[model samples]
Target chain A: MVAINKEIVTLDPHLIGVDWGSTCLRVFLIGSYGEVLATRTSAQGSSSMNGSAWAYEQSLEQLAGDWLQEYPDIKVLACGMVGSKHGWLEVPYVACPSDVNAIAARVMSVKGVDQRRFDIVPGMAYRPANGVPDVMRGEETQIAGVLSLRPEASQRSCIILPGTHSKWVQIEQGKVTAFATHMTGELFAILRQHSVLGRLMPSQQNELDPIAFLRGVEDARQGMYLGFAHQLFAVRTLGLMEMMPPSSLADYLSGLLIGHEIQAGLGWRLAAGLEQAPLILVGDPSLCAHYAQALSHCGVLNASILSNTAPVGLWAIERATAGVHATKLAHKVNV
Target chain B: MVAINKEIVTLDPHLIGVDWGSTCLRVFLIGSYGEVLATRTSAQGSSSMNGSAWAYEQSLEQLAGDWLQEYPDIKVLACGMVGSKHGWLEVPYVACPSDVNAIAARVMSVKGVDQRRFDIVPGMAYRPANGVPDVMRGEETQIAGVLSLRPEASQRSCIILPGTHSKWVQIEQGKVTAFATHMTGELFAILRQHSVLGRLMPSQQNELDPIAFLRGVEDARQGMYLGFAHQLFAVRTLGLMEMMPPSSLADYLSGLLIGHEIQAGLGWRLAAGLEQAPLILVGDPSLCAHYAQALSHCGVLNASILSNTAPVGLWAIERATAGVHATKLAHKVNV
Candidate 1:
């Protein structure tokens, strides 16, 4: 009934930042300085809740009810799939090149049970001139977090958020110019669990083999001409021939898919003449390390990994929205 | 108990040809003229068997017991996963560039029930001069069937067998010189069934949309620079953006995967300087037709479709093995 690992509670919670994604609901109680004073997480993700309006309110209340009671007027901001069409509310995507101000301007505010107010962040959509459009939900806030921490990055940088759908984003002057989504993690998970490649791997995962992993990265780099489907077949042949142990096959496959992602991502970067831009990865530390290793194999060495950027990102959006409101109030008084 | 759609019974069955793959068992009663007189099939593919000698024997008997009983001394030749490591017996792969003679020479012979001899054709392995090795079990026999039907194709040809693991094989002078395997079909199936992309598609599959299919193919060709994982995201975005209906998304995805296969297959062929080689597709007519259409979209106009090559291929291997035996007998008499 209570939040797990209920950390030191903030007596004066300034903001409540919720990173509600597809499968996990995480709420961060933020202090005035944008520090996470306490955190609560539950298995109740947006996808798990019933589509009914009360279900979303009930799920959020169950996780952060005590904090809400103590700080009745605390500004609450949530991001990610919670705003998706299938989520608690459908927040329209803000078209890129978007910035903190642009995103904050479009936040969808909703009234909860007993008149509690919550703001949901709008995601970003990118329509390339010549190709299909790409979209990202919670990652926009993560990118905002990166910009919050490293304002210099906003001048010109490429930030990669690796997960189910890894985003390779390009930022210029605090605005997201364009970004590409690579379904690396999702593909790897599905292939490992459902494809024939999974049959060759040990059911109990083994420690990652550096040699096999690097070999897969190298293979993906050199085998780009053959495309991915062909290169992936190596996972089977390598195991069938006993070239790699069963334990190492999964790691090798991981490296292979990530390598393909990096290869394509770098190509996307280079094609746009953004190769010299500062490259940073924002997400889980270990996953970023793998991406860094694969990127280094492909001659990219400037990628830095940043973790837990969502809360700060939420803070940044709140400040931007408040600033816009102040300017509007000032203009109204002058009129 | 009788075979489904039991056609004209062969009065004198020359050979019992079996194509046992991962999920199905098929038997062809070949007449003296190489025509399939009566055919039998079952769901007991090599993968479903118990891996015991009797299980395979029983599976075949269950399908063609009447034919086996009437033709006691009839030569039985089986191909595909039946000779794989997990099949009835592990048949070593014959190295490429292998002809019918080389493949038949490595045919693993096992004694079935009642002391009947069964010959399982060896699969082919291609260890490319560079990169990882590739292997195929039953497709080799299908290639041999192609050779039998069109002798000139042996001089130089590129044969594509489109299926779960689509193969782009090169043949020279009746031998399988080299090949590449694309996991297009398998990847499509898993992605459709398990991945986030599938979430946007209708649970009940709709008819193929040619326009959407071609759009995917064209996008794949133009978007090769972004790699497959990136191109694949379009399937989700198109649906989410409501640019394409749920019904057409699956077809678009199919086109995207097949297009990547074609692009990569063409690159592999061009890399080997076999661009001008005869391009022939052998497999299920509908599937092969899809590949053919995708290939034509890529500016490849000469691809011809051939169906039911496995039975003929089994017959070709049988004849080649018989000829080799006659040659050895003559040589012994001469000595």
Candidate 2:
């Protein structure tokens, strides 16, 4: 993942950065030079909104209107949870290689039974060509957008898109080949606020202590082999001195969660052969760095931090399209 | 556990039953045998009073005087949480083989440390020859008393003591040979009230579906080969229709937790060995029945219930020595 030149954020006229999150909806209006003319935020988050039969129109009017009303017509591209089944609009799920065209073709902008005009971005879906089925929502759009920027990153890279439900997508040759998600954040919250350990926890956001967090990782590896539940008892009954601070226990829970995911997602390789390929971790620098640090111990030496490219990659869908294709993807113009 | 023909609510010349639970202290004065002469309960729970100190004397004099005023010289055998470290009196933990003699030997009574004349019962202590260390509190006394009633239960009996912390102990030769405890009840409360599943669950307490509860047992078995943290995700995400009712989730979680203990406790057995031994389950009959039913599926064929034997067991200590040994177990006793 290479750093973008200074002009990238400023000069992409067709660029549009959209953040479709679990709890918030946000869209930024960018100019031909990638300059933000305006931004829109809404209370309805991804999981809460409907298929947009009525809502899609209202949110789109507010979001796309900020720029559309002025330019009265500059074409735009959208990404993120806006494509979810419950978003402002329901974008059909697309299987990956998942270029702008595949997703763009699935966009729906028809006035619904309620008479609303708004376009929906589509997400990526993966079915077992061989194993269990899985799906990805807004992240694949960003991954494609990310790869579009760095063509070299199109092959075999791990993209960590973090949030309450963070995803780690495996991209190969310009498409989101496969991926898995971890509910790390949610688990951390539950453990800290709800478990017996709650008594020992201090009320404050805690930092991940590299020293302590690593112990958790070690314990998970040791403990996963010995039943994590009983081992949890060991933490308390061993006495306060031996028990990791409730905060650290939180981290241990997180590590154990991710470790189990790695076990499931990686399977056989986790058994002493995870070196099949290097791992690329995205999201916030600190967390990705922590995951990378732990993965390193498991023998994955190359861990790169992918840019928080969700916004950049999301916005790039416009840049990746042919001018004719862009116009064609939109509602037919009437003059 | 044996059942007495005498009633618990009537009055006679005998002493009443005293229930010293972790949270409350209750004294019941019954007839010479087991008839309730008169009953009075108080808030001076086991932990609230200082070591068989002044508070016990003041409270007991008033409480006992309520009914025992007639007999005036009746003896009282206290049981339950009062024998804990925080109870009116701290009784030393008796080692296994345990019986009334050991319990009677450890009884301590002080007159308010200056005035109260009450002998606090002692629980049992167990340190495995090889295994993680743990301690038993009130359950030991209950088990000992129950053992006294069913002497043959000594050889190959399984005791199920349920509460905030539930323990399953295997007894052989009239001794609590080995045991494992799971905080099933506490975990149930925490998960139902605080975790994300809290959303999926209905607020009202409803009966747990045996199917769901059984699924929890099945899911908990994942502990043997997988970390529980991940296994829980399956329940949350897939929303196993079986484990859906939040109320039953407790029962299910209990099944899982208890099942884990049973497996761990009996892991050394060869195939098809669970049914080979007799099992004695002590607790609320209903809950004990559920546990026994679950164990039966795994081939545990012989499980019997122990009636309300906790108090009787404590009293057996007094009956065995006729209160003579009470003063002897203390650092020094004056009566």
Candidate 3:
């Protein structure tokens, strides 16, 4: 489905960057001037495609149908769980110390509907000193975006992507040196939604109480007397003792999980002689704010949040591969 | 119901011990000599009684139908979740530094279906140095049984009751001075049954592989580089890496949870200057063995398992109150 007049389409949009994650698909339309022209998002994630490669293609085509009709030759750059084993096409992980260029170089291309090209970015694998291998999918792109936006971050920084599987990544010279994954978010969700602790949580939705959340962080920080397993029970005990309200239970749990994560992640960094390193928090604003607050509680004064870096990261990776693909298209048009 | 001839029941059986828990009800028929004449068990626990006091009484009557007929005047001793807030009757917890006598003195009696005496033992509560209030119900009775069986356990012993919410109690001079609860077993079950980690486990039931369990225990023991939240992901990673089979995931998870529990429990005990104290493990045999294995892995050589101490503890509590109750009953008979 290559257009006869490739020159005409080349004058349209430069790149269409997509972050196809496990549960959500986010797309960014980048103009020739490297600016975000338009953006779109859908609930059709890798998981919802139901393991069918064809279903993923159909969903992608449907999602990008209107844009493709206007700019038929726009190249698509994708990242995250869309490249996982359970995703449409499995992409191999680039072992750390990997940079944006290294990740961009290993991008796997799959034939999209009507001859459109889809470039899927590879994730990063980290084997820490503990010998257990840790991996991250979508966060690598965010990290790439962070490095792209702030080149100063490349010198030495800890970028934390807080979410379901919160990641603590160490970057040096724009390369991810090492990283660890904490199941804090997932654990908090499950405990609050499915465990006995759920019974004590308020039925109605309540805005996160910062006071309660900080108290939880304090509980975890000062809870050297007991491990997390034991400290977790305090959530219920405190509720039973009327020390905290039912509505605050969620925030408290969130604080406990996030606090414990920071303690472990930062503690490791401190032990490894990176005590003075700058920290960058990345994710949704609310989540990032929580992390920043937790960091402050731990006396980490230099932490800052990088707001909405996934699109920037996707655009950066797309830019790396744009020249090569552009040359190929130019040659085809001349022929 | 009380028999018309009180002498017959007094001759028949002196005590009927019941461990009415959240999900199961266990009853022990004790002769005047304190030997278990017969036993009965059912799934009609406090939870199954569905917040109805009448349902609990009816369920109790049905469970002890034959025993009640034989010895209508038999004094009943009950413990466990039966006295919880949502149980048949909410019995107040006896604050710690509580022994068999203290617990027996606070035994709550409920009006039975007819004239039978239903005596429920009070649970124990401990506010540790960390100032978190911890409570245990049936396990305290088991601890009482441990103390009854081995009086030496009364002097600076750590009694570990391994189950859904495992309790580690510090007993000094036959008194439960303090205790802590670990959501290890509950956490393991939820992680395997509800979390994403369950996806890597086998669907079919497989026997607990000791080797795999020990590996998990070793992983937790040596996982100082990360917290349990981070190390838990190793279960999924190891499965994905093919380092461990899907079938062995259950056993491995068991090891990790139990290992973490022991580490936290024993670590606290050790910190409290009980490093040389003997550990008395009281629980079901299978669960006890796993804890024992983990304890052994942790280099604790003085650990012993106390199998099925509920009956002994129940009998002991019963004996404590038998004289006073009998004297009251004789007074009634004379009147």
Best by the DockQ measure = 1
Error of 2 at A298 (Å): 5.2
Residue A309 in model 2: lDDT: 55
Worst 10-residue lDDT window for candidate 3 chain A reads A326-335
Write the number of the candidate with greater lDDT, choosing between 1 and 3: 1
- Between prediction 1 and prediction 2, the one with superior DockQ is 1
Q: What is the interface RMSD of each candidate, in Å?
A: 0.7, 4.0, 1.2
Please tell me which model should have the higher TM-score, number 1 or number 3: 1
Candidate 1, TM-score of its B chain: 0.94
Give the DockQ of candidate 3. 0.56
Q: How close is candidate 3 to the true structure, as a TM-score?
A: 0.91
Native-to-model Cα distance after best TM-score fit, residue B296 in candidate 3, in Å: 0.7
Best of the two (1, 3) by DockQ: 1
Write the residue-wise lDDT of candidate 3 on B123-190 in tens digits: 88887665668888898888877776676667888888888888888888878888899988889888
Q: In lDDT terms, how accurate is model 2? A: 0.57
- Model 3 accuracy (lDDT, Cα): 0.79
Q: Rank the candidates by lDDT, best first.
A: 1, 3, 2
Which ten residues in a row are the worst by lDDT in model 1 chain A?
A326-335
**lDDT by residue for model 1 (B1-335), tens:** 12225576635668999999999999998765466777777999888886888889999999989888988989999999999999888999999999988988888899976889999999999998887999999999999878877777889999999999999998888789999999999999999999999999989977789999999899988998897888899999999999999999999999999988898989889987888989999988999889889999889999998886888788778878887321111111100
Model 2 TM-score relative to the real fold: 0.69
Which stretch of 10 consecutive residues in model 1 chain B shows the poorest summed lDDT? B326-335
